[model samples]
Target chain A: DVKVTQSSRYLVKRTGEKVFLECVQDMDHENMFWYRQDPGLGLRLIYFSYDVKMKEKGDIPEGYSVSREKKERFSLILESASTNQTSMYLCASSSPPWTSGGNEQFFGPGTRLTVL
Target chain B: SQQGEEDPQALSIQEGENATMNCSYKTSINNLQWYRQNSGRGLVHLILIRSNEREKHSGRLRVTLDTSKKSSSLLITASRAADTASYFCATMTSGSARQLTFGSGTQLTVLP
Candidate 1:
């Protein structure tokens, strides 16, 4: 099975503090994504990367950024954490690009972030 | 916006009984996937049905998609206590957005 690992499962940070959520996948997947899941809203894509150093904005990209320094690793950075940012963050990795096939994302266990 | 909307946000069923849930989405899609997530855990892919296909089955789960109505239904036969969890339908849109548009989800509780 696919193993997508997240840096932390539960996190707490003061408002205005910087936050980082890391994800790594063993399967050499080309597509990686970061999403925030909330009640009623479901899972909203924050950022997605097709290749190292390549990223694209999703439906809700404001106040969030991502980095893919390596093919297996993706990072989500919160410049300044806010109370509104407190939610469940999910990381996912997929096989390859769209032209090749519809990439099916395999997700990591989400990190519950709480910004007080 | 979420492409899919699950009917009956919550469902309760007796053990050994069947549970049926519906999902409706706007716009065309290449495929629709069902996922099961236990409390506080990552989602596990249950099944995927394509637009051309009307129905698909895996083990005890059956999924059907109706393009004309832009809706889908999932049926879990002989549901067990272990089957208690949340189910979500995700629509795989056409294009570079391989991203799936997920529904709000339906929470199921199976009573033993």
Candidate 2:
């Protein structure tokens, strides 16, 4: 079975602080993603990495950045956290679409971040 | 922008009854997927229906896709209290890389 693990289950940070959320997958998948879930707005993609050092912005990527220095690890970085960024952050990993024919994604237990 | 939107944002049903949720997308998609999320946890992939296929089933869950209407529906048979969760529909647009656009999701509650 595939396993995706997040760095934290719950986190708290003060305004203007830098925050990092980490995700690691054991399946050696080539694709990884970061998303934020908020009521009414749902899960919105923040950023995604197709391979090491490759990153793409999603619909809402203004205040966030991502790093994928290793195939098994993906990190989401908030340069300066704000209260608006407080939410449940989720990470997912999946095999390349072409190889698996759009395989299902494996998600980690999300990290609920509170920016105060 | 969100490509898919789920209708009947909240649903309440009793055990043994079937629960149905609908999702509609705006653009052509390569495939659609259904995911389930408990209260504050991450999502779990439930099922995926290709655009060329009309209907598919797994266990007690049935999924139907209509390309003409750009919509899909998920039916959970013999629903139980444990089935309560938020269900979301995600779309992988044709020609897109590996990203999926997710919908707002429907919160379903099953009472014993």
DockQ values, each candidate: 0.59, 0.84
Using DockQ, give the best candidate's number.
2
Model 2 TM-score (B-chain only) = 0.98
Clashing pairs in 2: none
Q: State the lDDT of candidate 2 residue by residue for A11-52, as single tens digits.
A: 999999999999999999999999999999888999999999
lDDT of 2 at B9: 99
Tell how far residue A80 is off in model 2, in angstroms. Answer: 0.6
Flag regions of model 1 displaced more than 4 Å: A97-102
- In candidate 2, which residue ranges exceed 4 Å CA deviation? none
Chain B TM-score, all predictions listed: 0.97, 0.98
lDDT of 1 by residue, A13-88 (tens): 9999999999999988888889899987778889989889999998899998888899999999999999999999
